[model samples]
Target: MSHSKHSSLSHDRHPLNFQDTYICPICRHGHIESLTLMDVFACDFCRHIFTANLKDQSIHVENSSQPMTWRWTGRNWQAANQLDVDLTVVIWLVSVSLVILPPSLIWLSSHAFPPLVGSSGSWFPAFWVGLTFTLHFLFVSWLMAEHYQFPLYVSTKVRLRRLLDRR
Candidate 1:
C-alpha cells in the first residue's frame, strides 16, 4: 500500500492469469503463481506472497516491512515505486554542509551571544566543530560506499580490527 508511484510502460499489458508464469519481481529468480483456491500469488524461490490488482496489472508484495509493487508489462515487470534516489546529489549537499555549517554556527553564536570575556574557551567550539565534521564525513562515506558497492560496510568487528592494525 505504501507504493504510490505507478510507472507504467508505453506498451499495453494484460491482467493476471493463473495459466501464465510471471517472474517474481521482488526476488527476480522465482515464478509467481497463484496459490490454490487463493487470490494471492506466491513466489516459489523467495516464498514472498503478492496481492494482484488485475485492473491495473500490478502486483504488490504482501507482509513486507517496506511495501514493493511492480506492474506487468506483458513481457517483464517494472518497479511501481522506484524513486531512484541520487546519492551523488545527497553526497554533494552533505559535503557542502560539512564545509559550511559548523564554522557559520560558531561565528553566529559568538556574535549573537557574545561570550564572557574571561570565561571564553576556544576548545569547546573546536570540539563541537570536529564532532560535527566527523559525523557528516562518516555519513557521506557510508553513502558513497553503498553507491559504489564498496566493501567498507563488511562487518563492524572487521572494521575495528583493521583500525587497530593501522597502528
Candidate 2:
C-alpha cells in the first residue's frame, strides 16, 4: 500500500504456490508449507525448513544432527510481526523519502522565490541550514538502520533453532 520503492517486494511480489510443493525438510517427504516471509518451504509433518530464494536454496533438514524444537515468546502473534524483514525494508524506504524529499522541495522553493534570492547576508544562515540538513539526514539514516538491522522474528527463529539444536 505504501509508495515506497520496496513496497511491492515486501507485500506481494513473490506469490508462493503451496500446491506446487516441495519436499518436507524434516521427514524428507513431499509435503512442505509455503512460508513466503521466511522465503522457505516448511515441512508441517516433521517441522523441517528450507528456503528457495532465487540466489540459492538451502535446506534445514531434520536429522539426528539437527533436531526440531519450538519455544514460547510472551508476545501476541500477528502476520505483520512474522514479516519483519519485509516490513523493515518498507519502513526504511519510506523514512528515507520523508527525510530527504520535503527539505529538498523547500530548498528548491527558496531558489524560486525571487524576493529571497537577490539579497545575501552573513554566512551564518547558510551554515545553519547546512547543519540542520545534515542533522536531519543523519537522524533519519540512523533510525532506518536501527529499524531494519535486526528483524525480531528472524532473529528469534534463529535463536530458537540454536537452542533446540543444543538440546
Candidate 3:
C-alpha cells in the first residue's frame, strides 16, 4: 500500500485563474491582472484588455466578440489580414527627398544656371523651371502614394501600364 501527499500549491492552483505576475502578452511592459468580469485580463501599463481562455491557456485581445484578426509578433501587434511591407528606409529616403529636392533645384536654376536677361535665353530658364516644378510635383505625388499605402485607381493603373507597354 502507498500513501501520496498532496501539495498545498497544487491545491491552490486553478486552471482558470490568472496570477498578477504574468507578463502582458501585448505590451510585455505590464503585469496582467484579472478584471471583475470573468476570463478578462487587462495590462496595467498599456491599458490593453484581453480575454483569457483557461481551457487552451491562450490569451486573446478582443477586436470584438468575434475571433481576432490580429496576432502579437512578440514586439508588436500586426493585422493578420494585411500584408506587411518592409519600406522603412524607402519611406525615410522619400520623405527627405521631398523636403530637400525642390528647394535645391530652384536655387540651382536661379543662381548657378541663370538665364541671360532681355534675350531668347530668358524663355529657356522659364521652361527649365517649369519642367523642374512639374517633375518635382510628380515625384512628390508618387512618394505620398507609396508612404500612405494608397491604392491606385484601376483605370489609372491600367493607363500607366498601357503607357509603359508602349516603350
Candidate 4:
C-alpha cells in the first residue's frame, strides 16, 4: 500500500514533508531546506540546488556540473547512480602510469630530438630527468596521502589560503 518501491518509507511515521530539513548530500556540512513552495531544495553551506522525488525517496543536485542522485535509505542517503568502479584497479593503474609515463616520454624525446649543435646536452638531460622524477614523486605522495587518510591535516593547502580571514 505504500508508495515507495524501495521501502515505501514504511519505516517512517509518514512520508517526507516539504517542511522537513534534511542533510545536504552534496555538502555534508550544510542543511537542505525547502525552497518556497516548490519541490526544489537548497543547501545552506554549498548553495547547491536539488530536486526531490518524494515518491522514490531520491534527490538530485540541480546546480552542479555533474548532477548526482542519492536515495534516502531510511537511515542515510546512498548514491543512486554510483558507478561500480574497483578501487584497487583504479589505484594500480594510476600509480603505474605515474611511475612509467614520464620516464618513457623523456626517453623517447631524448631519442627523437638530438641536442642542438654546440648546445649543452649533458646538464639539461640530467636536470630534466631529476625534475621529472621529483614531480612524479610528489604526485604519488599526494595521491597516497589523500587515499589513505594520512593523519596529516588536510589543510595541507585548502586552508592555508584562508589564513587571511579573521578567526
- Greater TM-score among 3 and 4 belongs to 4
User: Which ranges in model 2 have alpha carbons more than 4 Å from their true place?
Assistant: 1-85, 114-129, 148-167
Pairs clashing in candidate 1? none
Residue range 49-133, candidate 4, lDDT tens digits? 8888999988887865554788877656778975447975888688878977897788678768757767767557657867887
Ranking by TM-score: 4, 1, 3, 2
What does candidate 3's lDDT look like per residue over 1-167, in tens digits? Answer: 11111221233343334543344544444555687756687766556577765555556767323233334333333444333455656766776777567766776767786767787767765566667667777777775654442224323544576689799
> What TM-scores do the predictions have?
0.45, 0.32, 0.34, 0.54
- As a TM-score, model 1 comes out at 0.45
Best by lDDT: 4
Task: Report, for every candidate in turn, its global Cα lDDT versus the true structure.
Answer: 0.65, 0.47, 0.54, 0.67
lDDT of 2 by residue, 82-159 (tens): 335787588778877767776676566655653344457544455555766788788886665444332343345546
- Decide which is better by TM-score, 2 or 3: 3
lDDT of 3: 0.54
lDDT of 3 at 35: 73
Stretches of candidate 1 off by over 4 Å are 1-14, 82-167
TM-score of structure candidate 3: 0.34
